[model samples]
Target: MAHPLELAEPNVIDEELIRNCITTVEEISIAEDKKKEMKTETELHDIKAVSFSFQNILRIDNLNGLFSLVKLQLDNNIIEKIENIGHLVNLEWLDLSFNNIQNIQGLDTLTKLTDLSLFNNRIEELKNLKTLQNLNCLSVGNNLIRDVVHAITYLRPFRKLKMLNMAGNPCHKDPEYHMRIVAHLRDIVYVDYRLVDPEKVQQAREQYQEDLFEILEEEKKQAEDEKKAEDHQQWLDTLSEANLSGVDTLLKVMLDEDPEQGKLHHLSFWLEIIDEIQHEFKGMSKDFIDNTLNANKAKYAEKERFIDALRSSRQKSDGDSIALVGKFDLKKKKLMRQLEDLREDETVKKLRELQDLNTELNDDLLELGLRQMEADDQIVSDFERRYGDLVNAFVEAAQNGFFAKIRDLENAFHTRAVTMATDELEHFAAGQLEDVTDEAQIFLGDKDIVFASLNASHDAHLGIIDGLEDQIVTKERKTFNTLVAEARAESHTRDRKRITEIATVTARNNKEIVELIQSEQEGWNR
Candidate 1:
């Protein structure tokens, strides 16, 4: 038999551990401000910075959920693999030094990482970190890099990189390690832990003239691309500031400008999202209608047939008209109660689903807006893509209609059924008051009429539902088109205003940049 402690999970990062860590951290923050009271980030979504550095952590697991983590410290652990940290899209600083990790593989989604330290690991090569374009400080010293020159080249794409450390590797002893690696990179301010000497940098560049020229050319291209990206981003910021970022506005602009681009790509993204919401709601609606029909149809048929048999049977009743009316009233209450359930329960459920769908639509669109820039190629790309899905999405969205109309129609059916059933009972009860006929036969006769009325109402409600599909579709299309047209008119004025504002701001910022550059150099000397 295994020991109790050994049988349990050994190196798991569980909720209890996380709660302790987060609460301790929050207490420290709370000391500064009473309102900064920490909530347990067991889900790991709210915490901005954390350290699991000295923990006896063997693996990086149980760290799922959308992490808003900005800085994480996991150094000095027995970790051998770099896994389960990709959801940290906002992660910028990470320290995994002094570990048994052999590779730098799992850091793709960390595009915003600016500072990373993976020193004193078993890392053989410095590849697969290209996604971290924003990286400026990298420390991979004491690693297993076999070729310093080849490894240095991997840092070429990261033009923003300014610090590097390969001090304790095998290639650190290479005769050309200092000169060649230094020459290959342009913007590096520090190597290992020391400031780069200007005189030594010049000598190294001269020593490796041919290689330095290629490196310099590559750096030049990188600069140009960076500038292009900057300008594009500035334009995006201006567009956002102009207050023209709603889905309706975005779709309308794409639809209008698509002809010039000769592609329908941007419009299609909008269409796909709308279509998804529409498809989901339509599916819910269909299932609800099917269940309602299947459940109530049997009830109607059975009750109608039973009442028919009861009316024709020779069962005797000596009760007078008052007793007969009482019996009819009892039947009336039961039938009304059934109708109440049908009206309230099913309709309320549908209404709740509608509310849920509205919430879902808002959340989906919000996420799409957030993730949009990653896929955006300036303006939804060239106009050569398919428009079929786009058109379908719009049609579907128009038809989905929040399910309010459907719910109303459903209530109408239940109300009508109840009204008809009760009226028939009342009419029969009145006949009893006027003439005390064979009470059993009369009551059965009235019940037979009630079931017949329900059966007819059920058929009519189904017919109304069948016709509802086209009615909502037509109404929603008209509503969507009218809104789009109004938005188009509003956009015209906003476009002219946006152009003027952008031009003014660009000119002012350019002047400011020139002044800031001179001041920056002056400030650096101080």
Candidate 2:
């Protein structure tokens, strides 16, 4: 562990720093130790990246010769302006974040750029990005952008864009910004670091479809108009061809009675009229059931089937919750086992190893001290001076230097063991935290799914009930229309007069029914 990066963190962009970084191989991280070494040989035309980040640089400079550079990281600097890098036409990824850039300029030539970040800057408006047609990601977060309309107007062109982060901006404070972004940019996958839900996107488009229409470019507008025209044509065709069982046909006939009055509603709003007519039509809710004070016996049976379905769906959810709980229990038990192993087994084993090492060191020290003392005695007592003096000198050198060396080595060994143990514990803790967080999120997501499914089932059952009522009303309307047609056709004498009387009575009855149903519907809606 020694860090090889510069200590002074030079605040200026210069050639020396550039050359050193390009020539020296970046040290591999733990996660990347198995990967091939990064080639740092400075080949000007072949270089792919120049990382000048976290250099305390005040400005971007000295990047003149690197023509093939694709990634340039110049973030975390105080650079006040974007300049002198327009020659890097091959650049695809550029990050000049944590700077003071006010206006988005000098990037018009970078048509191949796909990702760009000017986060934490002073940009007030989003502009000068008409040429970055290939961009798929953009981040201008924590900036000074104020007008959402202006920002969206500029961002809408790059149709290839999928990810956008404009969080921490003044304009993002408004909740409508999120809705508007979803409505206008339907293709984006992520906005402000959150996934764009398709359901929300549909609702937003419906809410703001009119506004979105006016701002669409000519080509897009033409495409939309063509689609609408095609759909409208299909709707007219369906009206003519459909033997509609419901009041859809009857309502059209009533509305079309006056030749001067024509269709004035879209298909969606026209459904409301059908609904009102269905409600006003008499004997609508009575089905094949026999005449009794009650009409819901068959309906109740239908509901029972739906209830069974709902019950089955809930049972499945319950089983999943049970499995999830079991998983949680297993995780809890596994964590307990891990704690026991770490605290009681592994910790004790490591402590014992350290104790044994200390004991061995002390034993060696004691033996050396005894040998030195014995040599000292022998030299002082009767012995040949040459051998005794040689033994004495050897003993003294071993006593001081050997003891200090052994002590230093022992301390180093202990330090290494402690560091390794701590690293292992920290890694284990982080992994466990991640696992728990994932489990929590999974459970939360499952809960959302469960609730959403249950609600959908309820809505579906209610719809089935309404469908049965509509079917009964449709049968009634069909029968009445069939009888009227037969009665008019059968009359050979004064057929016109009879048809006129029958039509007049039908129109009056339809008028009174429409009024009553409209009142009921208004009150019900309120």
Candidate 3:
């Protein structure tokens, strides 16, 4: 079977279909003389990506014309020099590994390059990479680089880098290599050729930073929230009146003392006072009405009695008309005298006094009614003021500062998270490199060159063939483990969030019901 690299690489020299595909309008990547004799009208447009890696083994410099290219891969070839790669103004990725290049002066013009890998080459110095301010990923491994590390003056320009590999080089043998690399290249993710995945490291670091920021923000938010809550509670308590309980107690006392008021009875103690005054007035008025009716009745009774007496006198003096007349006249005189005495009785005098008292009580009852109306009005006004204060307190509690604090906390968390991610990536790079170096030293002690390994330490390294097989197996296992952990964490988080939401909703609903009941009770009492 062919080597994997050969099977994977594009065959640039054969096939008429491939030649036809390379039109002038389209992207055309051909070997040394493959497209030299082709005849066709190109119609390709929007050609932004192209790769010619390990092809055109005999071509020296034929990539100067592809100005529209953005990516070019020319690694694992016999290119002897680095030239004209800077002519492509839009180039972002350039890989020129496994070449005979010994210098690197022609890459200054590719200012747009963010990723550049020149591994397995004869280049000794990285002197021309100063202009690559936008460069993010760099690979300069498998080279005779003795003092290249010392020549790196600035690393601030490549602030966006997330991955870096510098294995298969002598720099890994430096005693303080890990420390120095971590101290300076802070954003690198991978350093040595191993399963040196830094995502977990970055995630842990970010999580820690996020937690720190969240704690600080939460503290600030909590403080503000507590202050606002306290203020709100104070206002609410004030509006409700710290004396509300006392007021309630007093109201209860009043209800107990004056049960008729609690019963909503129309006639209470005050009404009874009015009723007493009305009674007095009615008593006096009754005397006047009764006196008139009694006097008329008494006069009528006297007239009847006198008439009967006269008739009786006449009957006794039968046939003596003159005697009868004298007797009748004498009786009339007696009755007249009795009538005058009856009119001067004390009962009539007492009736006159009762009338006077009744009139005074009626006047007093009117005055009391007016006073009660005024008192009712004042009580209603007091109730309205207290209710308004309660509303104002609730409004104050819902101020904008509460949400602002939450937003600040969120922003601080994000910033700290990104910073921590960068730090962890740096650590991962150094750690992976050091671990691999140590593993090579331990397992391949007498070997001229240490190859691959199962783990990142020398003790984990097997024979070359066994190490490679173990690497494949371990990578698969590690990937599966990471997936499992992520899934479990996600499930736990979801469950917790769901439970909390349900509890919060239930609690809020219960609180609302309680408040409503209390309010209703207050209204009923008032």
Among all candidates shown, the one with the greatest lDDT = 1
lDDT of 2 by residue, 1-526 (tens): 2122233454666666665444222333433322223343455677777677777677677788889888888887767889888999999999899876888888989898999999988899988899898999999999988888788777877799999999999998987898888888757899988999999999988889888878766658778999999997775564332212332333233334423122112112234543554454322212211121132243334336544543454355446534543554454355435534563445444434433443443344344434433433343232223323433433343334332333343344334433543443344445532333443344323433433433443344334334533554455446445633543343333334434543454345345434544554565568
Residues 231-280, model 1: lDDT tens digits: 97775564333211221232233224333222112111334543543454
Q: After aligning candidate 3 to the native by TM-score, how far in Å is the CA of 511 from where it should be?
A: 85
Q: So what's the TM-score on candidate 3?
A: 0.31
Number of clashing pairs per prediction, in order: 3, 0, 6
Which pairs clash in the backbone of model 3?
A: 24-42, 25-44, 26-44, 281-358, 439-457, 439-458
List the candidates ranked by TM-score, beginning with the highest. 1, 2, 3
For model 3, what is the alpha-carbon lDDT of residue 382?
43
Q: Which of 2 and 3 is ahead in lDDT? A: 2
Using lDDT as the yardstick, the better of models 1 and 2 is 1
Instruction: Write one digit per residue (lDDT tens) for candidate 3, span 80-145.
Output: 677755668788888788777788778888888988888988776667778787887888888866
Judged by whole-model lDDT over C-alpha atoms, candidate 2 comes out at 0.57
Question: Considering lDDT, where higher is better, how would the candidates rank from best to worst?
Answer: 1, 2, 3
- Candidate 1: residue 119 Cα off by (Å): 0.9
